[model samples]
Target: MPIIIQPAEASHVLPITELVNLFAAENLMLPRTEESVRQTLADWLVAVDPDAQPDDPPILACGALVPLTETLVELRSLAVHPSQQGKGLGGHMVNHLVQMARERGYHQICALTLREQFFVRLGFEPVDRWSISPKVWQACIYCPKFHRCDEVAVIMNLVENPQAAVHPLARPAGWNTLLKWSEWQPLRLAYKQKQAQVQ
Candidate 1:
């Protein structure tokens, strides 16, 4: 069966939410409201199986790229159907989104993910989450487990020139930002515990 990769339509919104919420239920991601999906519908890209019968779901996978700054975008809400995992559809969707970001004049794209190796294989390198925009953290602050986050931050540079690939973070997050520092402490402790367990 052939799958089509394209901009999400109004029809795709519900399926995309359904697919993403399935993972969100497993604590793999933050649950999205239908209204949130509707609001950011334009930012979303969906992979659909157009030839499906009446019983089939219209979407197989979906992801969104949200701009944090003119040169940077945060890749979020990426989800693949459970039946569709390990089929390379996730990578294909990411590549398509990267191209779309480049076309739109973005210099870098970033994601906070537990699937670190997957994004690494797709040309993203590890970066400090604080290196991303506070707008990114603004969304995280709403997450229920913000105090014990398990996600890793990864980024990909889109410049054709190697030297231009380095993206300078807008403002470094530090002690001066009292609220962010307070929020990060628990996650820091959780990471330390994980590290201790591995030792």
Candidate 2:
């Protein structure tokens, strides 16, 4: 089926949440509520089948580009409805987001995804997760999977001579496989404080 991908609007909030939560139910992605979808609707894109009948769901897939810093953005909430998998909708959505990021003047785009190969095929290279420290500090620290996130971080530089463009947040020299103590200390302390308050 042919799909028209465009920025999500007010009408897309409900179906977008439904599509994302469908994958979240299977542990394939994080869940999103209608309110969260609405609040960030400007950052989201949806693919719709223009010819679908009235009874059919209007959204086929969706994703969002969440800004992490002045130069970096993260691809989040990418999902293709089960019925639409294998039709390249996911890649199409990603390409659209990448183009959006570039047009918005972002230096790089990143994603923490289980499907690393898929992103790699689209020119994103695997990067150490900690190198994107702002992302970890902003969202990952609060995630239940913080201690055991299985997703790989991938980045694509959207500039001339992409191969030579260093990652905006390149891992410091001598950085080990694990995160440095100082690097994660604040997040660890904050998590503890959050837990204490919850208790």
Per-candidate TM vs. native? Answer: 0.80, 0.82
- lDDT score for residue 67 of model 1: 80
**Model 1 ranges with Cα > 4 A deviation:** 160-199
Cα deviation at 121, candidate 1, in Å, is 0.6
Clashing pairs in 1: none
lDDT of 2 by residue, 75-139 (tens): 99899988889988899999999999999987778889999999999988887776564444555
lDDT of 1 by residue, 35-130 (tens): 889999989999988798898877899999888766778899999987788999999999999998988888778899999999999998877776
Top TM-score prediction, candidate number: 2
Tell me the number of clashing residue pairs for each predicted model. 0, 0
